[model samples]
Target: MSTDTSSEQRIQLRLGSEAATEELARKLASALDEGCVVGLSGRLGAGKTVFCRGLAEGRGVDPREVSSPSFVYLQSYEGDSGPFHHADLYRLGSMDDAAIEEAIDGTGLQHVLGAAGLAAVEWWEFYRGPVPQKLVTVEIAVENPEYRSIELKFAGQGLQRALDAVS
Candidate 1:
């Protein structure tokens, strides 16, 4: 996997295989704090799950327990700074008002923000845009047989600190 510099200054990481992506995720997990919403974008086989594995591990979660919750739609891991919520919004049946209200409300945004240091959302189109202004977005793109590109963009304070940690 290879990378290219983006005009937006987003750090692009090329992950060459699932393991590599997972490692990158782990690195990212270590830099997280409360109230962080990580927006993930990628296609199937884009290493989203592998990346998340690293994230869980970085958060001090047992990597053995990490799995894509595409079926259950959401999974929680505790052991890191705080609970880590891995949410897969791909299966939301509807994008209407009620569906979102149900999913986000029941999940309790405040509770999540307060308790979950990092919230990683896979297939983030489900967000319906207008993510919190403080969100940090990461876009993944496959570059080659073993390479995946990770681009990070931020919208709040402490971005440089996060970048320094990631770098």
Candidate 2:
């Protein structure tokens, strides 16, 4: 955990195994509140779904029920306190003018954001424009088959406090 010169609190964790990654995800889940949006960016097989599973588990949902929504676009699950929406936009193209318009209207993200609960969006960079201003971004990089580097950043003061507590 480190705070840069800009007062941006950045946390980096080395996940030695998938379990470690899941534990980190659970920690993140603890920091989340109702209506929280977690934006995730990573390459293929970067354990985004695994982290989401942990998040679901932390929310009292069965982790076994969580899966990548790449083909389906999004999946909604009943959480401990509210609903959880997991969205994947890997099928969508870049967020160009036309794409952004489509995403803003047709992607169903606006509805998810409007609803209460934890909304985790994978490939969030594609729809970066319409996401909430207080986005909590998580970037995961796979170093090996069993190792990952997870970086977290919060864009708002309240979220920064949550990150601090979790870190």
Candidate 3:
């Protein structure tokens, strides 16, 4: 793992297996505070959902209950800390910004993001709408079938603290 805590701070981790990725995500989740927003960007089969599952587990939710909300666009779970919201925007990639905004609003994503809980959105690059101020972005780069390079950027002090703790 490598970290840069400069003005544009970020943490990068090399995960050699799916389990490692999930474990890292769980640690991050545990360190995060409520009302934090996490945006995940990665290619298909990049373990985004796996990370979400770990995140849910860290928040005291059943990991098996967390899945990619690709079809439904969003899913919500009650966790020990608070509500955990998962959103997927892969299907909206081709849509224009306005349409994407409409879809987000229609799915109640706008309301859930940065609410009194943790919100994670997969394929977050597809959404061009205004994002929550308390946001953390994770970019997973596939190094191979079983390995991934994960980079995280924080946009809030709470998120930075969370990253520090996780790192």
List lDDT for all candidates, in order: 0.69, 0.77, 0.86
**lDDT (Cα, tens digit) per residue for candidate 2, span 45-126:** 8988898888887677888999998777788999786788888878775547677657656767788873688888888777
lDDT of candidate 3 over 59-121, digit per residue (tens): 889999988888999999999988999999999998888898888889999888878889999
Which regions of candidate 1 deviate over 4 angstroms?
1-9, 107-110
Question: Model 3 reaches what TM-score against the true structure?
Answer: 0.93
lDDT of 1 by residue, 2-69 (tens): 23222223676666677877777777778766767777778877777777777788888888887778
Global lDDT for candidate 1? 0.69
Q: What residue pairs are clashing in model 2?
A: none
Q: Work out the TM-score per prediction.
A: 0.80, 0.86, 0.93
Better by TM-score, candidate 2 or 1 = 2
